[model samples]
Target: MTATTTVTTTATTSAAAAVTGVGVVLPGLNEPGGLRHGPVAGADPVDPAALIGKKGLRFKDRATQLGLCMAAAALTDAGLLGPRGLLVPGDRVGVVVSSNLGNADTVCRAVATIAEENTGALSPMDTPNASSNIIASEIAIRFGLRGPNLTVCNGVTSGLDALRWARLTLRSGRADHMVVAGVEPDNDVTRRLTGARMVDGGAAVVVSRTDAAGAAAPRVLLGPSFRTEKLPDCVAALADAVPGPAREAAAGLWLGPDPSAVPPGGETADLSGWGDCSGALGLLHCATAVAWADSGRTEPVYALLGGAGGEASGTVWIPVERAA
Candidate 1:
C-alpha cells in the first residue's frame, strides 16, 4: 500500500516562468529523431569531448561535461547564445543543476587517495571537482552566467526543486533568465550507491519571465502549484488547485517509478524507461512536456513527481497559444 500524503498545498502562483527552449543529452535523445519516440535501447552514449571539444574538459567531471552539452543546446535553441557569447547580458542569466551523484565518483576517489596515499598525492587539476557545487559553478563560469547559481541534491525532489529554485529566482527579479539542467552519470560508485541502472546524460530547459522571452519562442508554464506529500494526496491537491474546467483540460506525465501512482487523467506518459535518472528525472519530465506542447498538443499537461521518500511535486505546462 502507498503512504498517504498530507493534503496541505504550498504553491507559488506568481507569474509563470516561460519555458522557451529544451535540450536533451540522454540516450536516444541526441540522435536524429530525438525524444519524440522515447529512449531506445542500444542508443549511442553521450560523447562530450566530441560535442564540446576537449580543451577545458581534461579534469572536469562527467556530470559537468554532460551539463554543458545540455545547457548549451537549450541556450542555443532559445537564441540566447551566439558566436561571441550570450545574446543577453551574462549577469541577467543564471544556472541551476540537480544531480545527486554528479560528483560522487570524484569525491570518492579523492577520499580514497587521501586515506591510502596522502593529501600531497591529490591531483591539482582534480581538486576543484571535489566540491559539491562544481557542476553548477562550471556551467555558470563557462556560459558567463553571473547571476544566482544554485545546485540541488534533495533526494528525489531535487530535479523539480531545482526548477522551483529557478522560478523563485526569476520571480524575485534576481535574473531575467535561468538555465536549468538535471544530469547524472552512471559510474561504479553511483551504481553501487543507488543500486540501480543509471542514465549517463541529462535534460535541460531555458526558462525566463514571459515578458523577457523572445516573441517567437515556444512557451510553457512551469507551475503555480507545488506540494510535498504522498503521491495520491499530492495529485489530489494539484487537481484541486486548478479551477474546474482548467483541471479537466490537462493531461498527466508521471515522473516516478510507480505506475500505480499515476493520477486519473485524459492521457499520461510514464517516463521510467529513461532508467534511473535519479534527481535529473524532474527536469527531464518538464523538458519532455514542453517539447510535446510545442509539437501542437492543445491540451495543457501536468508533470507529476513523487519520490520514495514521500516527497511529491507537480508542474503545469500551458502551451503558449493556450496560455492567457
Candidate 2:
C-alpha cells in the first residue's frame, strides 16, 4: 500500500509522521516496581519484571539477548503472532538499530586474553560477536529481513536517527516492513567510561504500511518534518507549544511532577543515560508508551535525538489500522 506522504510545519504541529506499531523491552535489573510516586489516581503501576527476562539461555550475549527480546516483545505488542506467515518469502523487511558502544564486554575480554602472556590463540568464535553489527545481523538472520539493514552509532540520537531512516524507507517503498531497534548491554567499560548511572535496555518497533480497509489499526501516530535543536532549546520550545495537558502528562512520566510545576526550560527526565548510551533512551520511551496504553491517550509520539556533532533530529509516529 502506498501512502500519501505529507510534510508540514505550522504553529500548531511541527509535522505529521506515520507509524504502524511499537514494542519495548528492558534488561533484568533491580529497580523500583512503581513510579517514584506510585501510579496515578486511577492508573496502575507497570511491573518492570514482567517486561524483562529474569533467567534464560546461557550462550547468548547480553546484547544479543537484549536485541532479540525487544524484537519479540514489539511483535507481540503489535499483535503479530509471527511474520513468517504474514510476510512473503521475498518481501522486503528492513532493520535499523543503534548502539553507541557495541559488545564492550566481549572486546574487553578478547583484549584481556591477548594480554595474558601464556594465553592461547584468541577464540575465533568470539570475534564476530564483538562486531557492532552483531546484534543487527542476528535480528536479520532470525527474521529474514533482507532490505536495507543499517547500524548507526550516533550517541543518544542513534535510536531516533534509526527511526527516521526507517520511516523514510517505508514511505519511499524501499521496504514494505521495517523494524527499528535500540539496544545496549551493561559492561564494565561502559559503566566506567560513562559513569555507573546509566541503564541498559532494548526497544524495537515493527512499522508497516497501514491497511486502509482494516478494522483494527495501530494506535501509534507519527508526524513528518521534525525540528530539533539543543536540549534546552528543544525543551523550551516544546513546553511553549504543546498543549497544557499533554505537557503535563509527558512531564509526569519523565519527572516527578507536572511540567508546568517546574521551570519552563529545565530538564525533565534523567538524561545521564544519554551520556553512556543515548540510543537506549529510545527503549525507555517505548516502555513509557506501553505503560501508558491503558490511559486511552491518543497523540503523535515525537522522538528527538541529540548527538556528539551537535546534530539533532526529530521524528514523529502516528497510529493507524492494523493488518490481519
Best prediction by lDDT: 1
lDDT of each: 0.77, 0.54
Clashes (candidate 1):
1
Model 1: per-residue lDDT, tens digit, 1-324?
985445543354535578887888986676212454667878788888887778788889999999998988888878898777788888989999999999999999999999999999999999999899998999998889999999999877788778888988988999989999999998899999989878888788888887784423656776565766666666655555555555663344434435565556656565666778888888887777776676666555666676555767776666566544
Which digits, one per residue and each the tens of the lDDT, describe model 2 over residues 199-274? 4555677665554221124455444433454444443344444454544433323221234434433334443432
Candidate 2, which ten residues in sequence have the lowest lDDT sum?
A: 30-39
CA RMSD of all predictions: 3.2, 8.3
Location of the lowest summed lDDT over 10 successive residues in candidate 1? 249-258
RMSD of 1: 3.2
Question: Candidate 2 at 16: error in angstroms?
Answer: 8.4
Deviation in angstroms for 200 in model 1? 0.6
After superposition, the stretches of candidate 1 with alpha carbons farther than 4 Å from their true spots are 1-14, 31-36, 213-216, 249-259, 322-324
Structural similarity to truth (TM-score) of each candidate: 0.90, 0.68
